[model samples]
Target: MAELSENSSGYGGMKQVFTISLALFIIFLDGSIVNIALPSIIKEYSTDLGMASWIINAYVITVAVFLVFMGKIGDMLGRAKFYNIGLVMFMLSSFFCALSTNVEMLILFRFFQGISGAIVIPTSMGLVRTAVPPEKVGSAMGVWGAVGGLAIAIGPALGGVITEVSDWRWMFYINLPVITIALFLNKRIFQHLREKTQPLHFDVWGTITLSVTLFVLIYTVTKGPDVGWMSWPIIGGFTFSILGVGVFYWIEHKISYPLVDFELFTNKLYVVGLISNLLGGILLAGMMMILPILLTEAMEFTSLQAAYFITPLSAAMLITAPVTGRLIDRFGFFVPMIIGYIISVIGFYLLTSLELNTPTLSILWRIGVIGVGIAMIAVTSLTVSTVSVQSSQSSVASGIFAMVRNVGGAIGVSLFVSVIMTSFNHFSMVSIQDSIQQIHSTSLSTYEKSKLTDALKAQQVSFFDRNYTSHLESLEISKNNLGEWKKMISDLRDQEQKNKVTAIHYAFIFGMLLSIFFSISAMFLLKKSFRL
Candidate 1:
């Protein structure tokens, strides 16, 4: 308890904030930087197109799995100890990632990187508690929040530049300098004080259960589409997850020092803030991940061009976070949060209506509006949730908050990808069917019909004919003269199928609409606590 108290706040606390926040920025930068380079990675690995996705999903799953455990670890070991270890691990993993020669190698390294990230993220927040006084905790947290937002905004652009100028590896290489600086500061000026004199007894069962449950749950959701959703693997995975959660909840309640204290949910603000973080993460992360891919693949922009178009959205987030933090500090989180959601609704509505030919500048401007709105709601909602908790529980509260955000991001990506796959598959199937029908109806000079009939017969046992082979051969020859016509039909239908992807973009629009609902709910819940 003394260690927790000492870490909570004082003059030494102020200096620690910059060191820890900078460390956190490096970890988060790893997250966002990879998004832009995913396309290039796909090309280099020559793997499944969707394999680019696992780079993100794997990283998210690893981080989400360890957050609660690491949060508990911070309570046991000193924050600075795990903080430095996580940093070293993250830096080492990044170096290996930069040297990776294959997709499998890259993913393995990325997983280790995520474990380090999980360690750094929660402890950074715990360190903040030690650094700032209670009255100004929100404001100090705001600054920490701003660093995260800036990294999110800049990460893609920086990754794009690195990918374009050299290769995708430089994005990881870029972390070394930042890590070096943070290490020096940490070693030279930071002091470590053990928090609890009593030997910390970890709830071993609770930790394993929670970690297993999250991993299985996320893995099931992510792979459900590729593997049959009802297949044994998915079903078994989900079953394990449910069992894990039930057991985890029971163990947590029974243990003297629970991994996550269930009592925290009794506070309305914590509940609301947690749920809001979830929905907000889904909204923001889905957009960031999908829009760039759409720009490059669906719209035919080059990687750099797509990155340029995304710049304004990141800019909007960067510009508004600090301002929103100040406003939340002064007036509370409700009104501004409500306004932000309303603005986001408008921006998403605009996004849904975009066409294939929509100008690049126009898209940027609309996304910027949405970005500003997100910044307003995101930081304040996070701040309000933490502030609502007693000082003693703040570290735990922040851990849960971060975990929600990570889970939400993973779910959001999985959901959006599922949407894209369904849309693309439907469009392809429909286009093919329509073309086949049109070919059947053509006045193919009798020759064309006979030719197609024989071709179909050769392709399928159902259409095979024994006696008509000679007659069909002649017909096939005549039809062969009209080959250009078949080519024309294929090209037309392919274009139409491509057009259907635009409609799929509206799925994202619906996702933002969900964000609106979340915002409204937050307003209803937080209205009574506006003073905070």
Candidate 2:
């Protein structure tokens, strides 16, 4: 394939850049918007945490599995052709997602949506690199990258307004107009771009071996709290996931065309950059997971309110990341990464103040600081990953970076939800036990005390034994005194609400721990620009 020098078609080079950037923005915007809207979906569907999590995990895990596979297909086939297919597939899936009646259906469609996303990401980048001259490639990519960062920054707020102002379905629907415009421009822009098909070997065993393992593993982790961790379902998922990963590593090493070459881990920069990538996923996914719970469940903010409150963080990132990226070109990686992570750590520490009455302003600056920190880390780490390898192997860097980031996101969201739910359940049980003990010690008559104890036992036992809330109405108590038990039920509900507050607090802490670890690791990254 000949390089597309500074050749001008009907649309100039910048128009092509705009089309690709819009596509990137469309994908990233959906990712953040969905996070803001998740709590509504959970409340509306009456689904449990594990079930609701699949709304996120299903898309991320599927994307992670398909990214490299699709990238290879892009190389073997036509890049622009697959990219257009991705656009159509994503639009259709988005429409179907709006039509979903159940959580399962929504998640199923989102999985398809992710496959479309996997196709678009690498192809879009490849297309941009082809259309722009070598000197201008970085500038075009910067614009492409900036749109993504901006989308991430504003998605929460935008999704909130969409959910609050209209319906959550509108978030998916919103993409149609944007995609329509991008597709219209991209058709002409992509025409001038040439596809260089390569003779590539398919890593069949490696792809299957790994995808199955990750799916099972993530499924297990997400459901561990809902189903007992030790239950056959959970245990089986972990068993297979673990065994699958082990097999995947072996298969990749043995195959001629490995999915992930173990040999790359030998490079110091690659190793460090990977750590940052995985942590980046955990940070993004974990914060998105817990913040909704905080805003909607604990702080009693509407989706829109939470989105507005969090906008500053993204704004800070939008403003700072580009400048930080420039710093990586001048001062090298070490200073920027260290400064970024340090601010992020401070931001996380401030977030420990997340309680029912915590003011919105406190959250804004704290999260903003963390965002500023990430701005520095995100660009620097990408630079590090690409620089760690030969220029020829830069595509490998992109693949590995996407793989870790998505896989880590899937794991992070699952882990955060599991930890939060597990923590909340523990708190709920303890509160329940204390209430029962208080009842036992009350100076009521013997028969009265006995009746209350038995009734409480029946209620708790019924609640745990059955899956539905209808079980609460079926408790064994005097039918005549049903109204009298209303006070007790109210008390239980209050206790449950308090337990939720505590759970969200702990989830924030868990997220902070991830940020702190990532910040610390950023200190050791090579203090140099990428060779490319």
Candidate 3:
């Protein structure tokens, strides 16, 4: 036992590291892997885009809300104990998620899965800290991060294959085997690994305030485009989010044991990293949410084909992440991060050039560059942020950083969807209006003009509402030649399809601008000296 400390894997620490990493893998793997199946979900449930966003957002927001609190609780209780319990709950919830018959049920199950994830993620860091020797902590952390990167890289492609061959439900089914192995490995390592429990207060008020603030804010954004920005529910959501934030600040300052310690935020590098995380989250999450939709909708790619486009991004990220980690360890944080942001800006710029005519080969490089950019930012920001604070505050620091990233993802989903919906509506309306004007200037009889005008107006309303089948029914459009309106309807649809392509391109441009903004914010990190 005494000689065990001589090696980093004392008392099976190496196995523990992999076990903990397995937990991290499942949570992250589930997030990205499920993304490929989102459109399938929307079609199966016959739900709109906004509700489908919740299938992802519900999980993210729950994890963000509970992560810090769970970390504190793990410290007070036992990190190992909490992690094991979380594993069981996570597995159970995931199973239920596979059985979901409707979107609401799936979202509800995912929320519970998120809660379990909150417990597992932060505690895995703690478990590694306990099991590995002090000198080897950095290497253990690097390995943990590498596993996480691989999960992100593989998730989309794996999900694509699983969803394509079997149903999407099989994707969830796949987790059961992984979970079983993880649980068994955990038992072996944890039996010998001991923890030093501390007395820590879980700040309930702090948790509630911050959680409500993020939930309300994201909810408002998600509902705004569909419900009308100034509608009572949307307005009320914004109001609650604002008040929740104010209350959170007051609670954190007043509470004896705040969930998010105020001292950590004072470190300038840490704050910059947090901001960068938020912006980075927005850029990546928005890109992930919109790109697949654009592929399926505009480019007419099947789910599997769409997954291939994501392959380059994930593949580049997988290769670059560990290399970036080593680079940061050698040269410190700023240079690599700056270069990454620059590459990401260029990557996004290239994405804005996408059109129906762009070849798949061209798209791969554009996606791959962004992946390289993501790897650099991820390694540098995490290193700088965690190193900026004292050892005691490290867990809280990383937890906050991760939580904010999740919040940003939630915000990005809403923001991108909102933008796309609005942009598409504008373009669609313009196309319809132009076509209507063309009919007015035609040589048709007055009665013919009036009849076409009424039909066109009805079609415009149905298109605006996204009720395509209803509009087709009302117009009596059939595969066979129906009437004189056939050519006219075909023209309108062609114009609308063109409008959709343009609008999606606009969303890509929006992401590009945000990527540029993130790159600029990363510059702020160099202004301060980091602990490393």
Candidate 4:
């Protein structure tokens, strides 16, 4: 392999950056685009919330677990070879995902799609480091980050329009064209830049232990609500996960070439950057997952309307990312990260005030605040992870950073969904029980009281079993009881809506607390005098 010049500059260098950035852009775009389509997917499959969530979780977990290993492979063999291969695999997986007829099939394909993404993301970052001169690496990273932000900006709206006019399947099909362009550009730019290959021992056991740890941990969190939280399976899953983590750590410490380099942990700057990235992912993914559901279910907005409302979050990110990159280059990551955290905390605080009747503009501005805050943290954290390491280790560092972020996203989606569902069920059941007690105190015949009580009791399981209104409509009521039944159903519906709003409000509160913790951690971890 020829040495890359420190003064490397020309059309070729710019083209290389653009090509790598475009590849990453699509990877991020895919993640955001699916949130808008989740409701439609659930309806089509008639799946419950737990099952519907797997559509996101399965992909995220697969990517998070495989990223480090794939990144190491790219370093050992050739990044360009794997990068191009990943593009092709991603395209094929997208096609299969579109063709899937069942939720199970879709999840399986999404898992494959995630594997391809793991290959592409780290390699793209590695390629960027190779393409640019050392002095201009920050600027090149700025362009990369900006493009990723742009992808997120358009993803929801694009998905909404596709799902509205065509089918949700079209969203998957749409990837084909974009990926084709990436493949073409990849071939043109990376052909001569391939690094010489070397044979190395792969850390297969370390990979397995780490994957098992994450999968079990995430699975337990996601399924705890459905099966009783104290059930044997959940208990066993947690025990296994804890043990797996210990084993994985031991294995990594013993290995010469570990999946994750433990040496990176010694770098305070790198560690803080990772912590910021993890927290950012949790907030960002949680917000994206819940907002669409809130809009469509609680506020009665169409998918397109919800997408339009959520656009500001990513739009703010797109606008802020480039500037954040430059700010990191000049003032270092500490200033931008601290400011970003404070802003995000405020955004989440405002989100806790959300009501069923909150106006669209109000929601827009709140999420927009979050977008700016997260963008600063996200861009800064990524730059820190890559540049803090030796250029030779850029791929591995990139992989570790991405792995933490995606793991946070998987956990966030699982945790938020569990919280909202459990809270909604608790609130709804209490309201129903109170309503039953009120009816019992009224002057009514024994038969009438018995009938009404049974109807309300049926609704105790309504949150998980079936639609509340549909279950009510299936009940038999006498002519004399029709008016009472209608009033009772209407009131229950109102209570259900209130319960959803309250549940979502609690999730925001959780996000706000996380932001505050992230802010405090950054302050303690990075000294006031430290820069970069």
Candidate 5:
């Protein structure tokens, strides 16, 4: 512990904080960057969307499942040692990911990359907690949150730029240089850190049951929409997850050296912080997934242009996170947290008003407002969760915080996607039915009416596939009703656009409800007058 305390002052402390943050930036960056490049990867490998999606899903599931296990391992062995080892593994995995010849290979390497990230994340927070003085912990956490927020927010933009300028593989190739610099700094800064010198007993069954439980739960959520939610496979997955969780807690209660110490949950502040963190994760992840789709699919912006439009989100978060941390350090977590939720609720309400003709500045400002609120909530919750526990337990606490947030994010993405698609389908069908009746009332020949009806049906089937023109051209309508055909097509296009806007509006309404719930939870659960 002396080695940890000795570096708690002056330039060395700041260097250590930044070094840990640098590694975290890359880990968090990878989580979103690959999403923007998924289409490119799909084209190159000649794979379907379902298969290409695993390139991202595999990494997320792997990270969420292994985070706590790796954190406990770091506690038993040494934080610095595992952190450095993870950096090396990350670099090597990035190399292999970039060099992969097929989608399967890329997914496999991404799983390895996820494992490396799991090893680094919790341990990095633990290192910061132990290395920084107690008073400055909030500020340190703020910096950590800021860097991570900026990385995740900007990842899509950077990926779009890379994919446009060079190739998707460069997304992975770029990690090498960043990791090299982090490794150099890590070795120089923590050279004197020593490992724990005690006999260790690993919790084999607990690890197994917990891992199985998480893997099944997340896998089920990720695939539920693709495969029907009530399908046999999904039902079985839910059943297995429930049983596995029961077994895991039973094992943990009986074990001498459990993977996760149940005592952490006994702390009221910690539990409240986690709940708030989970809600915040749901909002942030869902918005990140949907906003890009809205820009590209509805607004008809290119990927690069969409990325540029969303830049204010990252910028707002980067600027707000550090300041939020300092506020927590001075005034406490509760005030900043409540204020954050209020701002977020306002932002979500603004999002619900988005229209087809909404100006670019309106969209940018709405996103920026949400970003600021998210940054505040995120930094404050994380800082509280970290500071509420004993120093010895910081690594595991960090792991649990991270795992909950990831699970919430997964749920958010799944939920938002389901709502949006279902709503879109319903609205599209209504529009098509109305158009069909209108076509029936027109005084055209029976044959032309039948042709137009068939075209409407075809358009409904392939609405989201973005093949409207091709589908219409394939119908081979007679030139006699060409004017009516063009008019009908134009009306259908306008209705399609409206359906899209209505679907997104409904999604944001859901988001607003979530934001309100988040606010209510923070107000009731958190102490009104507490300070770090």
Candidate 6:
């Protein structure tokens, strides 16, 4: 056993690393893969979109809420033990999720899946820390990140294909095989990889406050559009989120071992990275949500074709992520991050220029540029955030960073939708008003006015004739037509509204610029840390 550490026997730490990474892959893939299959799920279960929609949000909310507390639990209990428990629960929940005949059962099982994910994700990394030698931790982390990234990159495409060939349920079925393999390998290899258990003291108040805060916050953003934001329920949600957050902070300050160490934000690296995560994720997610909508609505692409546009972006990201990861490990964070943000800004600029006539080839390349930018941001931001913290603190740091990113995504989706709607209304009103004014000015011929009076069945007033019936008739016709035109204009406005919302793809352009701005700012902060 002593010689096991010294002897360069068959990759001593590789199995454990792979096991943890495999678990990550399953969790992340399940997170996103099910998205493509959601419509099918709704149809299969004969459920309303509203209720069936909880499948995804329930999982996301549960994962986000419980992550910090679970991470802390891993620290207290054995990391591997928590991870294994999570794995078993996740697998069981997946089975239940598969067996679900209705929306409510699926949502219930999904909550369990989220709890399992919360446990698995953090503890997986924690287990890696315990299994690997100190010197190899960074490399193991890279592998872990890379696998998870690949899983994410592959999920939607894979889900699409599976759903197309078979049915949407296949997406969930796919996880069973992966989980089975993970369970087998975990039993064989990970049995010896447990961390030394510390005195277990789960902070109940901290957990409740933090979880409630996250739930209220995410729930409000997601549901606000459905239920009007100013409605009483939404107002209460916002109130609860604010109060819960305040209480969480207070609890953290007072508790002996808090789920989150709120003071860590004072660290320059942590703060910059957290902010960058938020902003950058907003940009990425905003593009992701809206671009697909644009493709289907305006561009008239099928779901498969719409997803294909993103293939270039995801492909570019897949290739660039590991390289960026290596660069982060070597040259430090600032340079690569700045380059990534700049690249992203250019990508967004290119996307902003998209028009009805934009060619597919050009769209593909533009998206690829954006993908490269995402790759750079993902690696550099994560490196900057996690590397500064000691291993014991990494899980909490990562959890908080993930939370910020998720919230950013939510915020981006909400704000982007709102911006597009606002722009649509503004542009449509301008167009309609201008069209009406143009109609008002062009004087109708006498012949037209005569016909107009007959249509109105009224004595009409005529242009430049005080007593002429033509003018009054013309006014009435104009008024009637104006109302018809208004309706047409409103319909036109709706169409144009959709188009402008499509055109408002420019939000990402603005977001990309914001990303560049923040990335550059992060550079200066990073420089100080590196120089010291």
Using TM-score as the measure, which candidate wins? Answer: 5
lDDT of 5 by residue, 313-368 (tens): 89999999989988888988778888888888888788878888899899999999
Write the residue-wise lDDT of candidate 6 on 1-532 in tens digits.
0012222333348678887788788897776677667778888888887887788888877888888877777666656667788988998898888888878998999999999988888777555544556445445555665665556555666777888888776666667888888888888775444345557777898888788788889888887755666899989999998888888889888978777877687788878777777876677667666777667665667767776677786678767776776665566668777888888888888888787668999888988898788767766666667666666776667677767776776777777766665555465555545544544454655554455434334332121122332243234345535565344334543455345544466566567667766765576565563520
Per-model tally of clashing residue pairs: 6, 0, 0, 0, 0, 9
Q: What TM-score does prediction 1 earn? A: 0.85
TM-score of each: 0.85, 0.80, 0.86, 0.88, 0.95, 0.83
Ranking of all candidate structures by their lDDT, best first: 5, 4, 3, 1, 2, 6
- Whole-model lDDT, model 5: 0.84
- Kindly report which residue pairs in candidate 3 clash with one another: none
What residue runs in model 6 are displaced by over 4 Å at the alpha carbon?
A: 1-15, 127-142, 188-194, 225-236, 434-498, 529-532
Q: How does residue 77 of candidate 1 score in lDDT?
A: 70
Model 2 lowest lDDT segment of ten? 460-469
Q: What TM-score should be assigned to candidate 3? A: 0.86
- Cα-based RMSD of the predictions, in order? 5.9, 5.2, 4.3, 3.3, 2.2, 7.9
Better of 2 and 6 by TM-score: 6
User: Would you give me the overall lDDT of model 4?
Assistant: 0.79
lDDT, residue 276, model 5: 82
Tens-place lDDT digits, model 3, residues 435-471: 6788788666676667667766665433233344245
For residues 1-532, what per-residue lDDT tens digits would candidate 2 score against the true structure? 1122234542247677778888778887766678767778999888987688678766777777787777656655666787888999999999999999999999999999889888887666666555554444444544555666678668888887887778999988988888888889887776655545556678888988877776677667666766877899988898888889789888987877776667777887777777876776777667766776677666667667767777776787677766765665566667776776777676666777666666767777777777776666665665566556543344444666667777777677778877777887687777667767766675555665576666655544211222322454455555555654555566776666667777876776776677676666665554444333
What tens-digit string does per-residue lDDT give for candidate 1 at 96-197?
A: 999999999999999999899888887777777557665556666766776776676667878888888898888888788889889999885465444553
Task: Show the colliding residue pairs in model 6.
Answer: 460-469, 460-471, 460-472, 460-473, 461-470, 461-471, 461-472, 461-473, 462-471
Model 4 per-residue lDDT tens digits across residues 457-510: 876444333266667766677777677767777887888888888888888888
- Cα lDDT for residue 220, candidate 4: 79
- Backbone clash pairs in model 1 (N, Cα, C under 3 Å; residues 3+ apart or in different chains), count: 6
- Which pairs of residues have clashing backbones in candidate 4? none
Off by over 4 Å in 1: 1-18, 36-55, 101-105, 133-136, 187-198, 228-232, 432-442, 446-500
* Model 2 / residue 301 / CA error / Å: 2.8
